[model samples]
Target: MDDGSAPAAGGYVLGSTDREMARLAALSEVYGPVTAAWLDSAGLRPGATVVDVGCGPGDVSLAAAERVGPTGTVLGLDAAPRPLELARARAAAAGLRNVSFEQADVTRWRPPAPVDAVVGRLILVHLPDPVAQVARLAGTVRPGGVVAFADVALSTRAAQPELPLLTAFNAWLLGTFTRSGRPVDMALRLTGVFRAAGLPDPVLTAAAPLERGGDAVGWSVVAGDVAGLLPVMERTGVATREEIGPETFEQRLRAQAAEHDAVLVNPLVVGAVARTPDGGG
Candidate 1:
């Protein structure tokens, strides 16, 4: 196992903080099912081999392992060691022997063998050149193998009954990410990325609207994400602690939701799947 304290290089804006880790864990639980369905659509099979790029905490990797069953192998790769530690621990706790993790930068890491598929979630948007990265990733899989990804288009998010704080907070978040040079709406570009990678145009699917109020999970997910981005928000002058502390923001959001009977529609999460050219060796 790699040391967990080494800092990540490249242009990753979201550093590994406790708050960010919590957000990733919550997000995994919320979006794992959607990722699994996307993998199925990519034709993942019971005995196929898959590589999960930027596999934070290994949630989707574990899901893929379950889908591929005992005979298959799932490799979860990440540049950060902290998340890989968590991922390995989770896989161990789940007694999933078929799944394993490695610490390596996704941009430079090449698989020891060609895999049946390559997949990632919310990873490409952080890259400086996501289409180029996708093309590189496509080389690690066998010809005709699957390459799939999922990302969020934050601009598409909306709140019913129109909560002002929520709206402002979302704007600040988008500005923060945008200023950092990350694409806040990477999902909308998946087809182009695939085509640029020399693969056929990808088939795309969007996750159903996530409704708030049935439980606190949805609210918690949003709160954690916003909380984790507070430092960036502050640095970018997008927001400040005095204006939007995590606790205060959650309280206000919940109060407004209750008062207005509002439901929060999360940003659209889009999944795309494409296959490498069959003749490409």
Candidate 2:
């Protein structure tokens, strides 16, 4: 919203914090633990200063601090303050003082100093111009510092005979993105975005949905994702917001999860890790 320009003025994030975070949590599925592994695999060493763009609720930021250890610093940037506030609480609860959260629309803001790594998870999709955002991120990290992100891949094809509804949901989600001006193709463009910003070509990898426990342990979070995506689908007239009632949606998704004898997870999300050149990009 707000035209993706300068800082939004104390604006609310389109939905209640509880619901919004829950929505983000669902579509993101395994982002937290997966991010920890992604950073480790990238060789982000101890004491590495990290910036987590779109650090909603701050799980990735705290994880980065844990991986980097006490010597490192983590700064999380986000557009909305409610999520940042929650992130701060999460950091405190996790006893991770090395990480802090800031409220700034990163599209118009840049980190003041080079960081050891720049990361975002499920974040770039909200940007109106992700290419420009990646270019700006390239400027914030030191030469050879790692920069990486992961998001849903639209080009993926699902062969989930067992979960056609879930598969259909994925298609509708991408359509919603297209209608909202935040096309899903950006998910496939991370590597190109890195290269275009003059950074090293990114090493790409992807994840397939695996079976989850029937309880999901994070079902409430799934409700949040339904909330987040509902707007997109509604805007595109793909689904009426009423049809996507969070409770009913989660109930159905959980039912689908039960049918999970093993169906493909629709989001063939891609993750990329790249080194910033020895010289500024």
Candidate 3:
């Protein structure tokens, strides 16, 4: 749902701090349904095998395990070891024996064996060459396997009544991403990226929730991200801790939302799923 995964060459702006890890969990909760729908659209079935790239703490990997059932297996790969450890614990706690987590650089990782499908969420945005990476991932699957990915589109953020604080934070988030050299609109470009990856144009879906008032999950999602990104925002000159007031950010967002009676449309997430060509092209 929210940010995860470091680039193969390193520098994932959202560092792997405890605060960031908690933020990622909150984000997964918010984005879980959307990602579930994406996996369904990818045609995961019982007995299918899947490899989840940049799986973070295995939220999506665990979901895929449920989808593919006991007979199926899931291998989740990420560049960070701490997240992988968390992912392992989560799977263990959930009693999901079918899913496993591993630590590896996404660009350099290879499947131990050909799998039914390859999937990722909120990962490509961190990569320098997503198209080539997608192509490589596609090749790791079986002949008719699926290649699906999900990413965020920050430009789609809006507010019905226009809460001032929400608007300001949205701008800060977008600005930070832009200045940090991350494509703020990777979700909007999935089609082109998939096609350029030498795969067919994917079936695309976009989703965003209109979170209303202070109590909504969106508030926490944004606040958590702001907390995680505070350092980057400061280093990149996009924003400063003093200016952002991380300690009061969530409170301020809730207060403004309550004051304005607004409904905030969270960032849009775009998902794309394409099938590998026959004969494993």
How far off is model 1, as Cα RMSD?
A: 3.2
lDDT (C-alpha, whole model) for all candidates: 0.81, 0.68, 0.85
In candidate 1, the residue pairs with backbone N, CA or C atoms under 3 Å apart (3 or more residues apart, or in different chains) clash, namely: none
Arrange candidates, best lDDT first: 3, 1, 2
Most accurate candidate by lDDT: 3
Candidate 1 lands at a TM-score of 0.91
When 2 and 3 are scored with TM-score, the better candidate is: 3
Model 2, backbone clash pairs (residues 3+ apart or across chains), number: 4
Clashes of each: 0, 4, 0
Candidate 3 residue 49 C-alpha distance from true site, Å: 1.4
Q: Write the per-residue lDDT of candidate 2 for residues 1-281, one digit (tens) a residue.
A: 32233222222223535667665555455444565566666776888899998887887788788888899999998877778888898889889988988888777777667788989887777676667778788778888788898776654634345554555566676566555566556568887877787777787766645434345534444345456556545655878866666557767766776666434444566778888778543
Candidate 3 CA-lDDT value? 0.85
Q: Clashing residue pairs in candidate 3, if any?
A: none
- Tens-place lDDT digits, model 1, residues 1-281: 12223213226555566766887876766666677778778888899899999898898899889988999999999888888999999999999999999999888999889999999999887777898899999999998898999998878777787888778878887887876667888888899888888889888877846676535455666677677667677777788888887767777777777778777786788899998889945
Displacement of the residue 205 alpha carbon in candidate 2, Å = 3.2
Q: Between candidates 1 and 2, name the one with more favorable lDDT.
A: 1
lDDT of 1 at 131: 82
